[model samples]
Target chain A: MTAVPDAIDQALGIAPGSPLHALRALRPEFVSGAEACRAAVLDPEETLDLSPELRRAIARRVVAGAGHDRLTEGYPRPADPALAALADGEMPEDFALAALARHADLIAETPAKAGPEHLSALQEAGFSVPQIIALSELLAFACYQIRVVHGLGLLKETRA
Target chain B: MTDTIPQVTLKPLTWTPHLPPVEIEDATPRQLEAMKVTPSAKKVSPYVRTLAHDPDSYVARTVLFNAIMYAEGGLNRADRELGALGASLINGCKYCANVHARQHARLTGTATTSALYAGRRDALNPRDAAIMDFAEALTATPPTAEQSHVEALRAQGMEDAEIQDLIHSIAIFGWANRLMHPLGHSD
Candidate 1:
C-alpha cells in the first residue's frame, strides 16, 4: 500500500516515490508523529480560549520570524486585522495578543532569555493556565516545524 | 526558588516551572491519560505536570519525541543522543542538555559531552565534530545547514536514513528547548 505523504513531505516538496520520500518512508513513525503534532497544535480537539485562527496567526508569525517563509506561504491571510498584524510580525494593540506575540518571538528567537517574568506577563494579560500552556506548545511546534523543514530542504539539496 | 537562573552545565539540574503545575489530584481524565507517557509513575516532576495543563499537545509531543529519539534502526542510539545533546547545547536549554548529556555519556563516554560543555568542538573525534557542527548549523534560526553538512555526514559514512534520524533528533530538541527553556529555569 502506498502511504500518503504528510505535511512535512509536502512542505519540502518531497514527491512520492522520490529518493527523499523513500528516505522519509524509512521512518514512518516520525513522519506520522510529526503530522499528529501539527494537528494537535494547530487545531486541537479542545482549544479552550485559544481560537484556531489565533493559533494559525501565531504559527505564521513565529515561522516567518524564524525565516522559514515557505511554512507560512500556504495559509491565507487572517481576516481579522489584529491577527493579520500578528501574522505580519506586528504586535497587536490588544493586551493579550501583544503578550502572545512577544512571547512567541522570544521563544522562536532567544528562548534561553525567557524567564518567570514572561509567564507572569502572560498571566497578567489574562491568559488562563491552559491557554498559556497551549500557546507555549504552539510557539514550540512552529520552531520545531521550521527546523525540520529547513533541515530536510538542505538534505534535498544535498541529494540533488 | 532563588531568583537566579542556572547556566548550562553537564551536571544534572533541577527545573522549576514559572507557572504552577496542575496538581495530580486536580488533573482531569484527559490530563491523566496524557501523563501516562510522561515519567510520572512514581512522582511526577513539575515539568511533566506543567505540560499536562495542555493534554492533547502534551500527548502528541511525547509520542513525537519518543519516535524521534528512541525509535530503533537508522542512527544508533548513542549518536541520536549526541545529536540531541548538540542541539540542546546550541539552543542553551540547560535542562535538556544535562539530561541528554547523561544519556550520551551512559551510551558512550563523557569525552564528547565534556568537550561540548567546555566549548571545545575541536576536541571531538571527526564523526563527533561533524555531528556537532551539523547540529549547530541546523539549530540556528533560519537554519544554515547546507549540502556540505550532508556531505560531511556522508563522509563519516552515515547513510541518508541515518542522517535523517540525526536530523530528527536535533530538530525535536529545537521544539523541546523552546518549551523547557521558556517555561522554566534549571537550577
Candidate 2:
C-alpha cells in the first residue's frame, strides 16, 4: 500500500486505498500544495523577524484553542518554558508575545471580529509589516487546518 | 476605504490593506515570482502584493487555493463558489464574500446568492440549502460539522469526491477570511 503521503491523511489516519484517501487523490494539487503551505507557514525559508519557535508555539496555541487536541500533537511545545507557556495558552509576560497570542486567538476564533486596530496593536508591540503578514499567515494556516481536519473527520465518520 | 467588514453584496468591492503593501518595483525576485507578475500581466491586486511580503507562504497558498477553487472534475465551479460564499459570509470577510458571490451568480444565478445575503436559506433549493448549511457548520470555530452534514450532502447526490471539493472550498476561505479580514478591510 502507498504510504499516506499527505499531512491531512496522516493527521486523520487515512489508510492508503481507503475511500477517503481515494477522494483526496482526485485533487492531487490540493494535497501537495497543502503540504507546501504547511512548510511555508510552519517552517518557512524566512522567519520574517518572527522566530521559528514562536511561530510553532503560536500554531499550537491556535490549534489547541480550536479544540483539536489531536491536531495539537503535531505541534509540540517549544523547549523554552516561555514558549511552552504560550503554547499552553498562557499570556506571555512579554508585551510582544502577549500581543501576538491575543491576535492569534482572535483570528482563529472570530476572524470577522478583527479590525485595523488589531494590526495597529501588533505594530505598537513592535511587529513590522512583514512580521505581521507572516503572523497572519501562520494564524490562517492553523484555522484552515482545523477546518480541513474537522471536515474530513465528518466524512470519515458518516461515509466510512 | 472601509475598516469594517461590510454586509455581503454583489457590487464590486476593493480591498484596502492595513499594512503597507510590498512596493512592486522594490520586490525581490522571489516576491515577484510568487505574485506571478510577468511583463504582460496586468496590475496585481493590492491583496496579492501585500501577501507577497512572505513569498513562500504566498506562493504555496496561491497554488493550494487555485487547485481547490479552479481545478476540474469533482464539484462544479458554481457549487464550489457557493461553498466559498458560505464560508466568507460566516467569517464576515466581505471582500472574499463579494468575489465568490459574484462568481456564484455568474456561473449559476443570483437567486442563491440573494438568498444567502438575505439570510434566507429556506429560499434556496434543497441542494443549495444543504451545501450552504454544511459550509456554515464546517467554517465555524471548533467546527460544528457533523456526520449529518456529510449525510446531507450525500443525500443531495454529492459524491464523496464532490463533498471533498466542497470541504476544501469552504475550508480555504477559513484561511482566506482570517488573512483578508484581519490584514485588510473591504470597500
Candidate 3:
C-alpha cells in the first residue's frame, strides 16, 4: 500500500492505481524530466487527476519549458493560409515558436546535468512535491533514452 | 463578495448574422457598460480572438449556437449554457468556467450557477442534470463514453440531432478548453 499524496487524491477523485499515482511511485532522482514530459505528451491515455491549480501548474511547466525560441515558430513557417485556417484561430505564430524552442531545449538538456532551475520551475507552477519528484525521475529516464538514441544516430535516421 | 443582492433582470438576446446580440435594455447602465467593456477589457490571445469576433460569438457561444440550432428536438439556451459549464468544469478550465458560469448565471440566475460550481450535479432538475453528467463523461473520458450515454439523453426527450449537436459541443469545448488552459495566461 503506497502512501498517495493528498493533492493526487483530490485531483483524480479515485484513490491510488491512477496513472498519476503510478507516476508518483517512481523516485525523482532515478528518472528525468524529458522522459516524463514525453510520456505526458505522447500518452494520451494517461489520466491526470489534476486539480484546477495543478492543471494550471502543468500548463505553466510546459510553457516555461517552452522557451522563447519555441514560442515564435509559427505554423507553416512562412505562412500557409490553409493550415492557418485549419488552426481555426487557435495556433498563433508567436506561441508556436515559443513552444517549439522550449521543447527543443528540454530535449537537449542532459538528465545528469539538470539542476534546481528545472525543479524550481515545476514547483512554482504548483506541482506538489511528490509530482515534482516524479517528473524529475521521468525526465531522467527520457534523457537516458535520448542519449542512447543520439549515440546510435537513431534519432537522425528516424527524422530523415 | 458583496452580500447585498443585486437586482436581477431578464434581457433576452436575438441571434444575428455575425453574432448573437445581447439586448440589455432592462439592465442598468453600469451593467451595459460592463458588458461592452468585456471584449476590449483585456488583450486576448489570437486563439480566443478568432473564436470571438463579436461579443456574442465566443467559442462557447458558437458551441451553444450549434447545439441549439442543430440538436434534434433542440436544446433550450439554458441547457446549452449548462452543457458548456459542465464541460468547462470537467476540463478544469478556469477561463471557460468564468465565461460560461457568468453566462449561466445571467441566463439561469445565480442560484443555478452556484449549485453547479459547488459540484452538485444531482441537485439540478433531471433533464439539466443528465446533460451535465453526459457532458462531464464525454469531456473527461471521451472514448469510454458508451451508447447508453446518448440513449440516456434521448430518453430525457432530447432528439438525435440535438444529441449530435451536444456531442459536437462537448468535443469542440474539449479542444478549446485545452488551448485556453495552456495559452490563456500568456500575453
Mind giving the per-residue lDDT tens digits that candidate 3 earns over A13-131? Answer: 33465443343233221122222233343231222332223222223233222222221121122234432322232323544323322332442232122333543454455554333
Whole-model lDDT values for every prediction: 0.84, 0.86, 0.40
* Local accuracy of candidate 1 as per-residue lDDT tens digits, A51-149: 788889998888775565557774456999999998889979998889888888888888878888999999999998899999999888888888888
* Candidate 1 wrongly placed segments (more than 4 Å): A1-4, A157-160, B1-10, B37-42
Best by lDDT: 2
Which candidate do you rate higher for TM-score, 1 or 3? 1
Fnat, model by model in order, equals 0.77, 0.84, 0.00
lDDT of 1 by residue, B1-187 (tens): 1222223335679999988898988888898878873444747889999999999899999999999988877799999998898888778898998899999888887777777776666667899989988999988886889888889999999987888989999999999998898888889
Model 2: clashing residue pairs? Answer: none
Ranking by TM-score: 2, 1, 3
A best-first ranking of the candidates according to their DockQ comes to: 2, 1, 3
lDDT of 2 at B86: 93
- Which ranges in model 2 have alpha carbons more than 4 Å from their true place? A1-4, A157-160, B1-9
List candidate 3 segments past 4 Å from native.
A1-160, B1-73
Span of ten consecutive residues with least summed lDDT in model 3 chain B: B13-22
